[model samples]
Target: MISFFKKFEEEGILGINRRIGEYILPYNPREYYPLVDDKWKTAELARQFHVPMPYHYGLVNTFGGIRNTRELIKGRPGFVVKPANGGMGNGILVITGESEYDNGSIIFHKADEKKITEKELYHHVSGILSGLYSLDGNSDSCILQERLECHTFFREISFRGIPDIRVIVFLGYPVMAMLRLPTKESGGRANLHQGALGVGIDLRTGTLTHSVCNDKIIHLHPDTKRKLSGRVIPCWEIILQMASRCFDMSGLGYLGVDIVLDELRGPLLLEMNARPGLGIQIANRMGLLDRLRLVERIHDPADGPKDRVHRMLQEL
Candidate 1:
């Protein structure tokens, strides 16, 4: 079943790219993303816009910097060490807390048995510094960010790690949203193709629609068998507002805004994608071409950010 779906996805790549072009009309992924993919710039924008983001402790941009990673995270119990240039949830370590091993060594547990020794952690950071996670084998930076406590709304569904809300903002209006739930198969991460569930969310009501797992429609979770519908996401208004604001901030006609509901901080912006995935269409069981056309007719990028957000709410 998985293989069949995998082949289907591979076959649909061209169609996916075409749809993205249709939705993103004037913008091209290769042109915009490469320019905005800089992690430091993204963080600065989020901060300037009052978009809550995880607290970054330090960044390791060189071999000498990697040597200081342990010292940087010495007292921080819960934090995440990630590669700035990594894609598809790769090279991310979510330190749950701390633990003492039988060998009298301290270790950090990320979910399940995903533990890392001090030496292993150093080696991993070194690998990132050496360009293992960067595009074109270029040297990379490792960012250590404060681990957010996942909100209770996701406790029942998520296995570990933070599950993000992906909002597809078209021309400064939020057109669609999907709650990506993490699972054991995804190593407690929310990459849907890795066996997580993509639950479509109604923008107006904040209620869940049907869910898709591995490209197959399912009413219940594969692991928990919990019915997928009727799940109400918290902070729906804030999520939509943040997504719309990104369009104004970046002057991009279309984009995806990833937000996570932190237990203490409420909704926080994780990252912005110039070209979001087409799987959101499958999850919503709707076509992006139609939604894009509708939003384009309604939204005016010339409008100020506050007015644009109000216009989006009215359109919704």
Candidate 2:
């Protein structure tokens, strides 16, 4: 079934739809830009808007920052070291704590069950510093951010790493949202194609509808076997408000806002993706062509945030 879907995604109706969907959705790859592409700019904007992001110690654009990584992480708990210009869920390290291995080698605990020796972690960081994770071959910056604890609500569904809420916000209104689940296949990551499940959500009710994994419909989790429906997300209203405010913050007509529900921190903004994935279409089993058209017809960027939100709720 997986192979069949891969083939269909490559050459069947699904493939064609993906191609057409890009043009139909205003926030498709070509239409949106990445906030992280410019590390300094991203930091400035995030700071200006009071968005809660991982605490950034320093950015390594030159050799100086890379050389002082030990100094940056000194006394800090386990933190995430990632490339500022990376994408596709690559070059990210989630450090849980510090420990020593049986072999007396110093290592970092990514989580309870995952550990990476200091040598290995340094090598990975070096690769990111050398631009292995950047879109182009250009040199990149590595940022050390505070690690966030996964919220309890997602404990049953998420394998590890952080489970983020990807919200499709159009014209300052949220149109669709899905909780990206983590799995072993995704290496504790939440990318949909990497074995995580995309659970569709009803925008108005904040209720789960259906879930899709690797293009196959799933009524229950493959690992936990828990029913996927009736999962009510905590802080649903706050998440919606944050997403709506982001449209004003970014000034972008359309965007995808990623919010991580931290165990203690409530809802925190992860990052904003201007060019959100079309895989959401398959996940939700609802084509975006009609919705995009609707947004285009009713959307007015000049609308106030409260008014826009009120209008959106009315539509729901």
lDDT of model 1, residue 246: 82
Cα error, candidate 1, residue 141 (Å): 0.5
lDDT value, residue 36 of candidate 2: 39
**Taking the tens digit of each residue's C-alpha lDDT, what string does model 2 give over 138-163?**
77778888888888888887677688
Worst 10 residues of 1 by lDDT: 8-17
Model 2 TM-score, all chains together: 0.85
In model 1, what lDDT does residue 137 have? 76
How many clashes in candidate 2?
0
Model 1 per-residue lDDT tens digits across residues 1-316: 9897676555443246565556566654455565345565678777777767888999988887777886787788788878887766777777878877788887877764577787788888888888787755787889998888889888877777678989987777787889998878888888887788898998887899979989989898777667879988887877788888887666666788888899999988887777677788778877555556566787675776556656756775
Q: Cα RMSD to native, each candidate?
A: 4.5, 4.6
User: Deviation in angstroms for 162 in model 2?
Assistant: 1.4
Residue-level lDDT for 45 in candidate 1: 76
